[model samples]
Target: MEEERLSQQLHEYALWKADVARNLGLYQNFLESQDNEDNELILRIEDIIESLSTDRIVIAFVAEFSRGKTELINAIFFADYKRRLLPSDVGRTTMCPTELLYDHVSKESYIRLLPIETRLEDTSIAEHKRNLDYWTTLPLQVESPDKMVEAFKEVVKVKRVSLEEAKRLGLFIEDMAQHLEQVPEYVEVPMWRHALISFPHPLLKGGLVILDTPGLNALGTEPELTVDMLPNAHAVIFVLGADTGVTKTDMDMWQEHVKVFSSGGKKGLLVALNKIDTMWDELENSETVASKIKGQCVSTAKTLGIDVATVFPISAHKGLLGKVKHEAALLERSGLPKLERVLSDEILPQKQRIVRDRVINGIGATIKMSRDSVKRNYDGTRQQLDELQSLDVKNNSMIAHLLQMTRKETIIYETRVENFQTSRALLMKHVKEMQEFLNITELDKHITAIRKQMEGSWTTGGMKKGMTQFFEQIRYNMTQVSYTASKANESMQSIYKRFHEDFGLVDIKPSILSMHHYDMRMDNLAKRAEEYRDSTAMTVSEQSFVIKKFFISIVSHARDIFAKAFQEVENWSKSSLVPIAVQLKDSKTALQRRIDNLQRIRDSKETVEGRIDELNQSLADFEARLKQLNEVCDAIHKPLSFDQPPAEAEDIKQQTAS
Candidate 1:
């Protein structure tokens, strides 16, 4: 029964991951054409949508130094973990934030990480010698557990003074040095803001992601990681030492930082009174010491207005033996199991309900985002339509006006081109200057120790090659990812920006303006996506919102006409609108090309994930096949020596001689 149930869980995780992948593709497509004013807000929405796919229930277990955070996780849920025990050496098992992920792929186990500021390939020992600021912002995938462990050993041992070390470098400022002093002494990833330890847990692999972060002060606090990562968590097991009680730091972590999310957000704080084994070693009356500590932990939780489930008194160092009497009871009382139930049986299902709400929320959210994006095309179209309204376009009267304008513009272009040529040169120079802000290649060197372990594996070789090929394709695709129904409308914006000095044509300039919807093509692509999405939203429903169907129909019809006008980038110089219209139309074609490319990639991913699903069954099949082979190959007795072979041959020879 349990085997079947586990198989079901594995299956569900696979489906869940696939569903997320599908949603991610949707978000990726939505994000591709973001070429205008509302992009920042759109990006935030994109972030929410993106998080919905990956880090939905990121329950981070954070604590101060040597408080037994790993032990606490192990104590509550070690029975069915990928391994029998959590990795603990010397004192701390985690020198970084070890994220325990329930990887829907590779049902067995995986430990992954996104490095602080380095891409994998560029990160090498030599790079570390240069400086800390050279790393890229790209995500880094750590190798398998054994290899990651080897690399981690080196990362922890590096002798260089961390950024914190420099900041706290004043030899006399021992007391004043706040963040930096924690780095030189602590065993965690010395320089990084957060070190990730991602693996498959028995319980969490069902649907949980248990993050074991290093001691807070020693690890260095990155507000982005906390701000982005923590609030998304479903529940937080804030582990503290029962023996030590709640320190000022611990109290601050709970009261100030943690409470921010407890209201309407999915995240909440739960205190764990870990390392209760130390109570037995006390010279002061052990019972009194234990009781006093437990009371304080409860008091701390009460101060925050949360139920203190159980102050678990555990000896995580005891190595999986039966816990002490008090510890065992505390384990039963600890809110982890309750918390797990809340996540799986209730919260998880609740989240599913929201997602499966007949795709209403997803459809609404996506459509709303799309309409706002496409509004620019409407504005441009309206301006052009008003220009045409003055002359009846259907009678070919406006065509003459267009011809006149084009001829007039032609006369001015010679001078405009001369001025434009110089400005364009200056703009290009400034662009190169701004491009220098992008160099993070130096940061990769510090993490070089990890790259060593990735060498010479068959799968690793294939993955490296595959990723290189993928990135190559991405480089090209990024240049022309967005599609539009009208090319002419987009070309106008491009033409306007190209010659204008303010639009950046000549010098080494920072593409800060480019950060906005600088790409006319991108704008057109966004407009196309928005048109489709809005058309979807405005579909005649059983219930009518605000405006009745008649007005909405008129507006909807007007919007389409506006879109047509918007796309008509009729070059006044050109006789027909065909040239620019064809260019805008290419966006649609461009969009289709991208979709085709993305579809092919999706098919490949689907196959890979499908193959990954068959792994356990394949493993079981392989095990049985090996067992059969072993039985057949068994030499229970002795080998067929020369003596035995010769006797059989000699008997045959004797019979022939006789």
Candidate 2:
């Protein structure tokens, strides 16, 4: 039952996300009703809502071959099927990296596989995903476990190819060839490079994604897996064999692929010492067996150089069998419940915090600005109503003087608008300068040059030097961009302060462009490059393979960093002045409306009583909208509760079955 906690937390997280999306929709509708012309704000809200709708919490399972990574996935997520959903028997069952997620967009269950031959192309896997023609598709019959199993067999399929072809695909290694007494003309390689399975499992439908990766060879050849996918996962479960403890290949995978994530305080990195049943001796007592498992876990932690608490000893084999047979005691003995509890308790809350922070920072600030604008308009209207009500129509001199005063106020507002336009021009100039520093086209030029240099190099050392210089140039560019961003921020702050002092305007601090994270990301990538350069494994590998991996993993990631910085700069440029502009426009419109009403009163064309009545109705409308806006804000800020008891796993299974 404790294993159900992960499912329960995922359910609650889904509900919470829906609630936030609903509130965002309400806010978007409110904005549309109030000001249809503020399309920028409306579009921003739409983007946030779209992201919430499609977001997935990705958990990647990484390990060397025969580590039970796939078996663990089947036990934890697919136990309700009463059988193995993924191929997990014997050696090298899953030859390629596989992804399991619900197809929220298509609402169809299917398996998509990318042919291994596509690796010969320059296009990345991410690019291939966008164009379905590159992948072979198969319909998945989720209702029939046997059919699903048969379809999943394609992931483990392999084909014999000439050794030359395998080498060209970057699948051949000299070390692997050296193992043979005689050089073979042909070698077997995975038929597919990647597998994506979309089915309507409850957890998958609740926005959970499971990434099952193959061994080190696959990780080394497929650079995107290490550079992009693993790093982006919400949590990474590195499965280790309890029978072998931490092997050399496992340690290599950890240090080269997974250890960098640990530097971020190891919050989302977890170790699963799988196949603990290997140490389950019939002659030993339960306490003795558990002690051995615990000792192995500690040893694994020591070898991996991580805290022992992060290492969990589990038997994926028994866990799957227990769940299928409905034997709770067997499952308990498998040590799955404790691991599940920690995963649910730690990962879900951390994910929630990340989503909460993004929503608060993005939509929350915009809503506050909108509310302030509405409040200002309401207050200004009330003041105008009070002033109008004080006037006596019989006193023509008083009405004339009031009309003159309002016209003068209109002139002052017009003057302020002109001054704001000049200041805006200066701001735009600074924004242009900032944009120059973040120009993607310029970054592309740098990338092109670096690629040429690396390609022209004859030796591994020369290419490694080129790789180092590539990152150095990128780092230098980011530093320049950061400096320019700071300058632009200063100009924006000055503009806000001037308006606040000269005319009564709200002093809204502009959104800062923080490049520190990107800077740190580049630094990490550089560090990874250095490690790769110094790697004995890479030294033994082909120079061509090394170059391809460097570009795919390191250079591509650096390019992405620059792209994101460019996008952020553009967004900041557009939104930084929106609030003040909205307020000023509303103020000017209010002033004009007052002048028109008072002039009519002075000309004896419209009654003072009539004008007062109109003002009263307008005031009431603003108040009602303001109240609704406040309620929407409250809904957006409301915290989600996760203390409710979880439903039994059997109940969840039945519901999904239905």
Which lDDT tens digits does candidate 2 get at residues 269-335? 9999999989999999989888878888887888888899989889999999999999999899898
lDDT of candidates 1 onward, in order: 0.41, 0.82
Error of 2 at 467 (Å): 1.5
Candidate 2 ranges with C-alpha deviation above 4 Å: 642-658
Q: How many collisions per candidate?
A: 41, 0
For model 1, residues 1-658, the per-residue Cα lDDT tens digits are 2223433443454354444445444544544644433343345445545554553445567777677776665644553333325554445445545556655544434333334333112332223324435422222234343454454443233224444433332111233334463534422233433343334444455556666666644322232224335545666666777667778767655554455555434434556666556665547785787676567667856765666653333455442333323344543433234434443444444444444442332233333323322332333334333433353324444455455554554445445556545544444443333222222232133113222322332243433443243223322322332222123234434444553443232222111122222233333333322332233222212111111212222222223332332222111112122222222333333334333323433344433234334433444543543343232222111121212377774563343233
RMSD of each: 26.5, 3.6
Error of 2 at 386 (Å): 2.1
Best by lDDT: 2
